[model samples]
Each structure stands twice: as structure tokens, then as C-alpha cells.
Target: MSLPTWELIRAAGLTSYFLLFVSVSSGLLFSIKAAKPKTNQLLQVAHQSAGWFSLLFGLFHGLLLYIDTYKPYSLVEIFIPFTTKDEPLLNGLGTISLFIMVLLFISGDLMKKVGAKVWKKIHRLALPMVILISTHGIMLGTDSSNGWAIVLYASSLAIILSLLIVKLLLIKAKTKKVISA
Candidate 1:
């Protein structure tokens, strides 16, 4: 039995993006100390779970493209940046985002060995990963012009950007407090 590769690719990509949103939101909440201690623990778990699933779904999304009868992608084309004939730049961004996601996942897992500072530095790549994936979807996705997809892209970008700004403000405030002491 053969599955519908194109539909699966779209579904997986959308699902991955949604999970990434959840993960980022949860991570921001956790980092900002917005929840109570008990709830914070739950948020941490949610963040980790969502991140793992996001990566999984993202990999599924990319792999499905390899098997797509309409537009089959070679492993090299899919994994390497700017190697595809179709939409090279946008697809390259997606490919780079995928590598960043994988790096984030691995660095997170090896946080202890990598040290907190290094892990945090690598975690910062989440911002660019979101941007790349959003651009890839908005520009290259087949459903990008649809109302629901448009809403999803815009709203997700808004929410994530808002939270990021809040996180930055909180960091600045904390720094000021430390300096004033």
C-alpha cells in the first residue's frame, strides 16, 4: 500500500511547524519564569517533548519529499543546501533550518557535556530556525495562499516574535538589576 506522498509531506510539514511553535512557546515560558514552580516543571517537559516531536515530524516531512512522485527529491538535494533545481534559495533555507534543528536537538541532549554556556549559545539558533522555516512555508508551500495557512503563518510569527521580544526585555531588566546592585 502506497501513501499519498505530497499530502503527507504537507501534513508533516505543517504538523512539524505547529509542534515547533509549541516547543518555542513553552521554552520561552520556562525561561521567563512565567509559571509557578510545579507548572514550570510541566512546561519543561512539554518543551522537550514538543521539540523532539517537531524534529521527528520535520524529518518525516523532508523524507516524504524524497518519495514524492510528482517531484521526487534526491537525498543530496534534500539534505544539502541550494542543491535543488526547484526553489533553490528557499529550499536551501529549509535545509539549513533542518540542520539547525538537528543541532539544537543534539546540543540539548548533550547539554551536560557541552556545558551550559555552549548549549545556550546553540539554543539561540532557534530564532533563525523559525524564520527560515516560516519563509520556506510562506514562499514555497503549496497551501501558503490559502486563508488558514496564511493565518497560521502570520499568527505563529506574531506569537513567537512577541514572546522573543518579551524574553529579551526580561533579560535586559535582569541585567539592569544586577548592575544596580
Candidate 2:
């Protein structure tokens, strides 16, 4: 039996979210010097691949909404923020987050051409992107109430936040050391 469109949409969304979590985690590991050189190389590959997959799945999730029989979304509603009558605010958050993710992905690929300084500035947006994406999913996702979904969201948040804290502390320590030197 064929899976329903709504189920497909939900699956795509969840898969995209998980891929995004992987990409961010890999990036954080590199930033915090948590991996050995050889392992870091593998992480770099995973980070880039996961990022592309996340964007593709995210786009697919949005597109699937168009094909949904119940409360179908228009192209405008899918791409444009706050254009829909139903749950405009929550959906708009998702649309905005997705756009930010796209920007991050494109800029990441062009990091060398853009220069490390500029690329790092753009990369900082990842934190806010994660926040917005998580909020959008937890607030709007149909499966969010399920036990597995709840665990996924909670654990993802906890791990990401913990890594971010470590990154910040390491940066502060380095800055202090440079000043003392």
C-alpha cells in the first residue's frame, strides 16, 4: 500500500531535521577541536554531505505540502513567510528558517571564495537557524507530541546547546590567552 501524502510530508520533515542536526554537530566538533585530524577530515565530509541532504529534504518537505489533499499549500504559501491563513506565524517561522538554511549552505560551499573572515560571520547564523528551525518543528509539527519525536527534539536541543556552550568557553579562553601573551 502506498503511504499517504501527509505521512510522506512528515517523514521528509523529520528526516531533514535529523540531517540538519548531524551537520551542525559535525561543524561544532570542528570548531571545538573535539576531533583528531583524521577524524575531523571524515567529519568535514559528513558535514558537507549532511548539509546538502538537509536542504534537499527540507525543500522536499515543503513541496510535499503542495500535494497534500487536506489543506494544501500554494507555492507562495510554501516559500513566502506569513502568506498563509492557517498558522501563519508558525509556518512563517519555518519558511524564514528554511531560507536561512539555504543561505548558510550556499555560503558554506563558497567559504574559500568568500574568505574565512566573511564566511565565519555567515556561519554564525547557524545558531539562530537551529533555534528557529527547532521552534518551528516543535510548535507546528503533527508528530511532535509522539514520544520518539519528543525525545528527538529534546535530545537534539540538549546536545546542540551543550556544544555551543563549550565552543563559547573555548573561544573566551583563547581570547584571554592571546591578551595575556
Which candidate comes out best when scored by lDDT?
Answer: 1
Instruction: Note the residue pairs that clash in candidate 1.
Output: none
TM-score of model number 1: 0.96
Off by over 4 Å in 2: 1-3
- Candidates in order, TM-scores: namely 0.96, 0.95
Q: Which lDDT value does model 2 have at 46?
A: 86
Candidate 1 per-residue C-alpha lDDT over 46-119 given as tens digits, one digit per residue, 9 for 90 to 100: 99999999989999999888989888999999999999999999999988988999999899889999999999
Pairs in clash, predicted candidate 2: none
lDDT of 2 by residue, 1-181 (tens): 5448898898999999999999999889877877889999988888889988998999999998998977789999999999988999889988887898888877877988998898888888888988988988999999999999999999998999999899999999999999999
| lDDT scores of the candidates, listed in order | 0.92, 0.90
